[model samples]
Target: MNELQHETSPYLLQHANNPIHWKAWNDTSLKAAKNENKLIIVSIGYSACHWCHVMEHESFEDETVARVMNANFISIKVDREERPDVDAVYMKAVQLMTKQGGWPLNVVCLPDGRPVWGGTYFKKDNWMDILGQLQNLYTTEPERMMEYAEKLHQGIQILGIVEKNHSEAKSNPNNIKPLVEKWSKSFDWEFGGYARAPKFMMPNNYLFLQRYGYQTQSKDLLEFVDLTLTRMAYGGLFDTVDGGFSRYSVDMRWHVPHFEKMLYDNGQLISLYSEAYKRTQNPLYKNVIEKTLTFVERELYNSDNAFYSALDADSLNEVGVLEEGAFYVWKKEQLQQLLKEDFEMFAALFNVNDFGYWEHDNYVLIQSQSAETIASQFGLTENELLDKKKNWEQLLFNEREKRPKPRLDDKSLTSWNAIMLKGYVDAYTALGHEHYLTVAKKNAQFITDKQWSTDGFLWHSYKNGKSTITGFLEDYAFVIEAFIALYQATLEESYLHQAKQLIDYCLEHFYDEEKQFFTFTSRDGEQLIAPHFETEDNVIPASNSVMANNLYVLGILFHNGYYEKTALQMLHHMIPNMDYASAYSNWLNLWLNQSDDNKELAVCGKNALENIRKIQAEYLPNIILAGSTKASELPFLQSRFDEQNLLFYICQNKNCLLPNTSLETTVAALKIS
Candidate 1:
């Protein structure tokens, strides 16, 4: 066993008992490598990565492979979650060298921590051959390794630059339409998701198009949006047996999946689908939102009402061999036995035939048709079909429970929890369901009580009653977003005030004055070999874009000139690269809203909170509501609340129309603007 046994990351602890001595990334490990004159082998992966486990069991566990690793290098294992800054630099190096990258990232570095060469997953023989050759080359030609390391170091320093500032800024909504239309045409209209195999459900991309569709009243954009979400909902990528989505679909048709479910993907998906449901009122979107939320509550949530990170992709099969889809795939005989009378109906509706069959004749269920159509063809009512499906699903779920379960990674990350919290808030706001609000409030309280410090700062990770690691810019950015969302949902001033304090903290510490964007790590945190200013969107939206969004909201709430100026500067920085707008769609969306006529609805007096709800049920993305029961909460509502009467005030740019008690009157006035 090595030092990883004492660490908190599940990824590191998984290798605690390996034959090769492994060390967590720290100053001591780097110092030891330099002192011993050994090269450093840095292998980074996460807990839920399937190939990471494959590498561990295949190469790291072999005694001879361990000997080769131990004698020639100082091996280090890093969980990308605990130290993303380190991961970011090395991943960039690998991408620059090879033009592609994924998890199980293996890099050979010098003692000073500059990566020279790297590649992703390798077979055991290829891995051993490469290690032997690396050691031989290092000893025979030391100068060659040093030269490559220096070159890679220089390249890493210049990666991912969003412009410090831009010239000739303008808010033209027309510029975005062509780019979005071109990207939308790439969709796999017959199936779901974008064209090609290995499809990822990028929720923000859909959300941007969705909001644009609603704003422009474009039938084509709306139809594309509906088609993508509908196909995904019916595809095998969604766990038809369960209620959550896997990480991504491995096929364009969404018939096969890589089956690891992550909290971040599900969280963003909930928000995206809820907003779509609110705009279109499609029952398909509503069913997805509610079922996904149910899955989260059942499997991912902890006792503290916070969320865990993910579920593993692999589980043990009936023969005691480790397999990838053991927990999910079903045999044809098992279905027939379980759903005796309804076997044909269930099998036909869910495509349990050869079309859905995978390796060894096991099936991954993918929807073949809508329930209404199937019911009509089968000479039954829709209600009868629904009841039959639900009953058969419950039976399958019960039988599936008898199999070995997949591993669950229980680390509670502040940034991911914040995303899920935002998901709950969006669901509540869109659906006006009391339980969703209650859940959102509970998670918000959990973060405030546990992850936040007394000085109003934040922590990155919390597990087993302890929260450690200084907060990165992402933790603060996402949590601030959640706070702003809560304030909108409940009209609670404390949430708004707390969000302001967090933004001020970012301004003081995370901001780079010369770069004009926030760094991924705080100035006070332990420095990495290379600092990163992340401004592009990936699986999650970039921190810079999220911060820009927070600044925009705060600017409107308090009428702060500084906040508006900074937000506009960030938006201008994005203008030069509008051609790559799909990756930066979240940041580009700020301008989409700016291109429209926005309004602020300020409600006051005794029934102000009640009055706010009348507007809440409607789809009003352009409307901002601020309410005060008495006075002094909002600056504009200082004396607007009278002693006896309730009123609605429509205001924009410090101009108020009139205060009246009629909801329709306020709606009519808002429409005219």
Candidate 2:
């Protein structure tokens, strides 16, 4: 075992027994690199990454490769989930050098830690050759490597340059339509995602599109969102037998998933499907939400009610080799033997023949036909088909459990847990599930008790009853957002107050005054090669974008003019940099809030809580909610609380429509229904 044996990250622990002497990223390892004048190999990947495991087996375990790495370099293993700051700086370097980047990110840095060379996964021979060449280059002429490292470090520093746009004209609903038009050219109208292979379920993209489509009354865009959501849910990207989504599909059709399930993806997806359900009342979306939450609960939910990070993509197959998708994929013979008389119907519903066939006679269950279509073809009722489907799932789930399950990355993260908590809040609001609300509150309380500190800040990661790692901006952003959602759901002033406190902490620690944007790492945290402004929306929305949107929401909820102005200023700085709408979907969502139709749904009266619940159930994308059952000092609810009757006021920028007692009439006035 190496120094990594002492690490808490599962990814670092996976490398603990490697022949290579791997050390976790810390002051000791870094100081050793500079003291010895040895090159630093900073390889970053999460535990669930299949290619990361592959590289570990093919190269790090080999004695010859280990000798070279151990002698020439000080190796540091980083779980990207745990140290995103490290990953961000090095990833930017790799992207600058190669114009692209992915997991199993391997970078060779100078002794002081400026990256000299970097790439993603490489073959053993290539990896060894590159290491040898780089070592020889440094040994022969150290100045050459230093020069390149300095130049690359400079490039990395300016990667996410955000210049403040001093335009007085704010981004409105119509101003962004042309940006969507530019983005629409890449949309795979037939496949439901972008026109590309390896489709990621970018939940926030669809989220923004759904809201924009509905608000603009664009039938084409709305229909496109419906098609994308339905196709994604039906595809093999979604676990038909289980309940959650894999990370991304290897194909555009969403027919072949990469097979790792991430907490962040599933969490955002729940919010997407839940909101879509409210708008369209699609039963399929509800099923996806319920099933996905079930998957989360069964696999990732911790004893403390917070969620774990992820499940690994690879698991031991029948042959005892680690294989991707082994636990989920099934052979035709296995399905035939299990289903018997129901086999034909099942095959038709989830394409089991040629369409579903993968390598090695395995079939990944992907629905090509809708349940209604399959039921009509089979001369069966919807209820009968639903029963058959449930039975088939039960049989398959039981059988699959007998196989070696995927390894769990059991460490919990503050940002991801908060995202999942928000998911539960959305599920409860949309479906009126008491259990969902109960679970959300429990998790929220757990975060407060365990992850939060008495000094008015949060810890980033928690495991084994210990919280470590100072909170990053992502942690504060998502938790504040989740707490606001909780306040909206229950109208608990304490949750709102908690969010306000966190927001103030972020302003003090994470905000960059000159850039007018938040940094990814807090000032209190360790400084990396360069500070990153995470602005792009990938699988998870960018931390800065989430923070900006949170600021906008809280500004309205609390009626704070200064907060609102700061949010707009941040948005102004980001507008010029939004080259891709999908990449900046969260930012665009904030832009949507600036539209004239946006409302502050303020309720204060005897039945305030009841009315807030009803208002949230409707698909009101432009509404920010706040209320109190009793008299409150919040500007939105001040002097408006009536003890005798429930009153709902639809206000915009402190101007109000006459308070109405009828929920239906008030909701209809917003033109939501």
Clash counts per candidate, in order, are: 0, 0
Give the candidate number with the greatest lDDT: 2
**Residue range 268-371, candidate 2, lDDT tens digits:** 99999999999989989999999999999999997987899999999999999999999999999999999998899999999998989889999999987778
Model 1 scores worst on lDDT over the 10 consecutive residues at: 162-171
TM-score of each: 0.96, 0.99
Cα lDDT of candidate 1 equals 0.84
Best prediction by TM-score: 2
Question: Cα RMSDs of all predictions?
Answer: 1.9, 1.0
Minimum summed lDDT over a 10-residue window in model 2 is located at 164-173
